[model samples]
Target: MVYTISAPPHKKQRITFSSINRAKILTLLPVSLISIYFFGLPALGILLAGILAAVATEYGIQMIFKQDVTIKDGHAAMIGLMLALLTPPEAPLWLPVVGSFIAISIGKHAFGGIGSYIFNPVLVAWVFIRSAWSDPMTPLSIPHIGQFSDLLLEPGAGLLVGVSPIALLAGLYLIYKRYVEWRVPLLFFLTVFFFNQIIAFVSEIVTLVQEGVLNPLLYLATMFTFLELTEELSFAMVGVVIFGIIFLATDSPTTPVTKQGRLIYGVVCGLLVSIYGLFGNYVDGTLYGIFLANGVASFVEARTIPASFSQESVLERSYNRVMEKIPSALKFEVISDD
Candidate 1:
């Protein structure tokens, strides 16, 4: 009699690795189609280049290494589509190809594949391409900006996914499906919103002062009376923040494991985005911010884990060792009742 030995996830559930990828693909399909509608053939060409390059690269690497072919799982294709969405519409075809190649070979595979990777592979590839070729990464200006519909449907500036409200709705579905947790994305948005408002308010105050407006107290009183204290916040990159927090920052393997750690990590990512956005470009800042946060995710997870009282923690052990070195008179022992 032969007994088959299998991996630890022996208990079956509806959500499998492949199923998750399929859900992601479905969620992102609308975004891709809308990108084509707005940007036309160039967008189509870029999307194809990224997807094909990622799939082909993953296939070639697996074949050469004589490993099980996992391309059918759709992880490679998802990475490709995501990279393409973040790309500028006018970017050359070769750009996605190169980015996809890097994403598969180095970003995904080099770090021990899929769940073992420490960084979001798409963001890794994007940084590489942007740093190497800054010129082509600049997005083209939209010809006209008139109706509010344009902002929701197509604002042809910054990254392709920057102003896409569809992306936000799709991201919400991912949350509903239980594929992603609500903590990180929620904290990230809250941090960005509050920080941005504070910055804007301070800037407005400075502007008023520069314009020779007298009686600061009167300005404050008028603000309170009219309820005009809060400035209108621009959510130009809300789509980018939503999509990124959902797909990139919350990547199961790379992000924090504990709920508290995830919340802290999200705030850190948002703060970095806000700071970088002030000093540089918003789209670039979002990518870099997430990348930096990924670097510290493991550390955050380690510290956030609740220490067991039954076992001695590292800090406790160290303190005990230090106490042992001190003179007997200097340390008092607690008397335990029998």
Candidate 2:
């Protein structure tokens, strides 16, 4: 008699590759439709090009390497969709194809595929496209439709997702579905806001000092007012922080695992955003910031993970040394039973 055996994972997992990918596609599809409606044929063409290129590239690579084909898993399609969303509407049709190829071939597979990429594949493609063809990738002009229509659809400029409020709703849905942790987005927003306020305050203080004004309360009031006005005028900033926070920066494998490490990772990404967006004057600062943060995620996890029982001996030795430093009168010795 023989016993049939199965691979590990005898326990069921609540989250899975298909589930996560499906959730993302569900949310991204609406945004894609909205973008197509607003941007017209060019937008649709880019999306199709990106998705097709990504799928074909993945299929070809898997076949060549004799690996199991996973293109049907929707991960490749999701990457393509995301890359299309980040692309400018005026970008050439060939642009998306090139970007998708890089995303699937180099960014995804080169690092060991699906879960092993360090940077967000979409952003990786965008960086290369932006660097190589800065002229064609320039931001397109968005038509402003005043009044109630603005609430439903506000077309500002830049990337497709950058101009859509629908992206925010999709991000919220992703959070509700538990596909992403709320902490990272929360910390990221708080950090961006905190830094913005600080910068505003410092600027106001310098102006007050130059003007020889003595009333500090007046300066505080002025700074707060200015910040409020700035927030209203710079509504486009939402897409930068929210889109990156909810999707790009929160990739499970590329981000920190433990709670404390995630918090730290969030803060690090936030600071980088502040630095690049505010000081450096970069348009895609949010993407770049999150990409850089991915590099440091492993370090954060290494430091924040709790010491296992195997390392307790080292901790015990340290404790014993501390105890030895105390005087015999102050130290309590363990009495052994003979």
Which is the leading candidate under lDDT? 1
Q: Candidate 2: global Cα-lDDT? A: 0.78
lDDT digits (tens) for residues 152-187 of candidate 1 = 775655566654554556767878878888898888
Query: What TM-score would every model get versus the actual structure?
Result: 0.83, 0.83
- What candidate 1 gets wrong by more than 4 Å, as runs, is 1-13, 142-148, 207-232, 311-338
Give candidate 1's error at residue 85 in angstroms: 1.0
Model 1 clash count equals 0
lDDT, candidate 2, 1-338, per-residue tens: 99968997574548778788888888877778888888899889989999999999999999999999998788999899888888888888999999999999988999989778887788788889888998887675532324334535666646777556545567677788788887787787778777877776777788888888898558678656654645533422455556787888888878888888889888998899878877553347788888888889999887778777667544476788898898999866799999
The clash numbers for all candidates, in the given order, read 0, 0
TM-score for predicted model 2 compared with the true structure: 0.83
